[model samples]
Target: MTEIHVRDLRTADPADAAAYAAVRRASVPAMPATAESVAYTCVHAHPDARYRALVAEADGEVVGTAQVGLAHDSPEPGQGYLNVYVHPERTGLGAGSLLVRTAEEFLTHEGATALYTWVLDTPRNRAFAARRGYRASRTAQFLRLDLARAALPPLADPPPGVELRTAADFRDDPRPLFALDAETAADEPSDVPAEFDDYAYWLTETWRHPLLNHELTTVAVVDGEPAAFTLAHTDGDGRYASGMTGTARAHRGRGLAKLAKNASLHRAREAGCTEAFTGNDTENGPMVAINRWFGYEVFDTEVRHVRAVG
Candidate 1:
């Protein structure tokens, strides 16, 4: 008889990180992840988050993983999230169920009143979430672009008084970029309201993230002030992902965000990245249209599901 159980992932173990990353990559190819990034997340999560990387083992082999945590940045209390993925080859072995059960128990104990997760938009996945009593919410799409061959839009010169630079240019002081990011994040559509006032947390979690590629991240500066920016993440392989693209509220209608993204994508292709990926909420029509114009296609979709923890 096969036995399956879930436990907190050993963050410092390289092998554990590798196994967790392997399962995630095999389960969702569109989502780019690496051992280094996984380990970083496991170790660097905020204390308020009560974060846990849970792994499911079947006969002592890791085959499923989940990221469970409280939404520390949310304005509301008792909001939590848990995303689970199992190795495609190891499905039907009860690994996923064990992981979910373990994660829910942890979140409930952590004072979570609501639990949210993303389920791949498929019949089986949808049915599984439904059985778990999670009601469907918003939908998000994973978009991909052939960065190696697709004809990316030509990089255009910045308008007068506007200059283009990489994130590395702001290495001395990234506070401006942080402010812009906070504004954009606040404007983003989400079920849970996010507040980004903690600069220390932002520096630790976002700016210093392992996957961030400062050289490929483009920023638009207007008259020496940061206006818009596009963050880039790469796995040292050919895969590149747009982490975020946002224009300051004052800088809207100037095409600054689009300009920054185009510049970043061009730099990514030139840097030998073969594939580019990004995600957008279905409600974000403007961003979806921008990505569509960049030759990205919807490769997969995931529906956000939520349930109240009794």
Candidate 2:
């Protein structure tokens, strides 16, 4: 007989965080996971975020986990998300179901009217979400590039008054980056619209994120103004990911986004990152083209599943 139990994350226990990270890495190899990242998220969630990290244990070992929370940054109210991952080795133990149930109930109680999740495009994963009342919405592709072999675009010399810099250069004052992020994020294509008007929240959640690579994050500066940037994150294991890349509205159409990303990728490769990963909405043609130009190949895809709840 198989038994399963779901419980909240014990941030105080490093072992618990490590176990959660292990399960996540085993379940979703495309995503970067680390014990420090798990602990940082648990410890620094915004006061109003109402976040929960639940782990499902079967036969005395954690076999599944979920990160459930409201989309507090979205302009639309009552939007929530629940992403569940089950260890590939422990699938038949009922841990996945238990984790999903627990996560749904938590979101429902928090007044979420809609819940969105990303299910890997695999048949089994799609079926699991469908059976749970989620209808597929849109698909996104995950692309990976072998940094060691991929030839990155040459770094162009910044125009006379323009300069290239890393995120660390702004360590003493990151408000400029935060402002640029807010502007760009507000216009990103997504089912749930976000409004990043809260600087303090972004400071705590994004700027201080554990995996963010400040030195590898390339920023484009024009006349000392941050115009474009590519945020980089690393897992300390040779894997690097492009967390976000965007250019200010006025700076768009000038290849600034591409420039920043190329610079960041080159820096990551030089820093010994062997693999690079990034995701783009299927409809985001420009970004998809940019990644393709960088020699990234589509490796996996996930479809967003959404369900309505009272």
Best by TM-score: 1
For model 1, state the Cα shift of residue 113 in Å: 0.6
Candidate 2 residue spans exceeding 4 A from truth: none
| Candidate 2 clash figure, as a count | 0
Per-model TM-score on C-alpha atoms: 0.98, 0.97
Say which candidate scores most in lDDT: 1
**Residue 27 C-alpha lDDT in model 1:** 83
Q: In candidate 1, how many clashes are counted?
A: 0
Model 1: per-residue Cα lDDT over 42-73, one tens digit each: 88999999999999999999999999999999
How good is model 2 by TM-score? 0.97
Worst 10 residues of 1 by lDDT: 24-33
For model 2, what is the error of residue 24's alpha carbon versus the real structure, in angstroms, after optimal superposition? Answer: 1.7
Q: How many clashing pairs per prediction, in order?
A: 0, 0
RMSD of 1: 0.9
